[model samples]
Target: MKLELLASFFLLTTCFTAFSQEKQDTAVADKGLIKVSVMYPYAEGKTFNMEYYVTKHMPMVAAFLGANLVKYTIEKGLASGIPNQPLPFMAIGTFYVKSLSDYQAAIAPHGDAIRADFQNYTNIIPIILVSEVVN
Candidate 1:
């Protein structure tokens, strides 16, 4: 019947619309990107505390700084070609921020607090980088 065919058409259109909207929302969420690499040189016997800092303290600081934690990764290898030399641990934390200035301002006030909390873990040198989402 024509009525049944019309009903089917409407249902199909509605489903497609919902799917399209969901895709758009996901794309928006994926648009913002911020990356920070924290280089750490740990003292001997402080390796365990370094793990604790990454797991527990870093998240707290990231939250306090208003950063949405996207992902965290670690890579270990020789700092140079020397086999016996201990390479520094790199903690790479990715986040999503609205803008560069917004990200800067968010952490400006907490500089001292952040340093105090993280000083026990290791000597940290934070490198901040930003990128655009291209898909």
Candidate 2:
């Protein structure tokens, strides 16, 4: 009976932890007015240099993107819902901006340089998305 109670307690704690983490993740997503996401899709067997991305690539983005870059989030996808399944994306990067015009203006001058840096990190082309934060 004691062992069963302990197991039940552990399960409840785990569930609560997962729930709170998911809530926190969603809250982060809701931040800022405009968001620009660059998602690198996962392949069956491929390589991505995460070290270079975080260290070199992101710093370059911040320097070139300028002060208009309100904030940014970089995510390294681990796994899918199902156990042992691969994640749909290798990495997902979001840049928070105040407006579309601001983002366009800031990125315009640096677009070529930003594109050029991709090879230093990963060979895969990322899919980009620009969206308004609703909520």
Clashing pairs in 1: none
Quantify all predictions' global Cα lDDT against the true fold.
0.62, 0.85
Q: Highest TM-score: which candidate?
A: 2
Q: Give per-residue lDDT, candidate 1, residue 85.
A: 68
TM-score of each: 0.49, 0.73
lDDT of 1 by residue, 42-114 (tens): 3455443547676776776667555445544554433645676665544444555555576678778888887
lDDT of 2 by residue, 1-135 (tens): 999999999999999999999998976766657888999999966668999998888877877567777788899998887888778899998888777897798778999999998988887889999998875
Q: How many angstroms is residue 20 displaced in model 1 relative to the true structure, after the best TM-score fit?
A: 22
Cα error, candidate 1, residue 7 (Å): 40
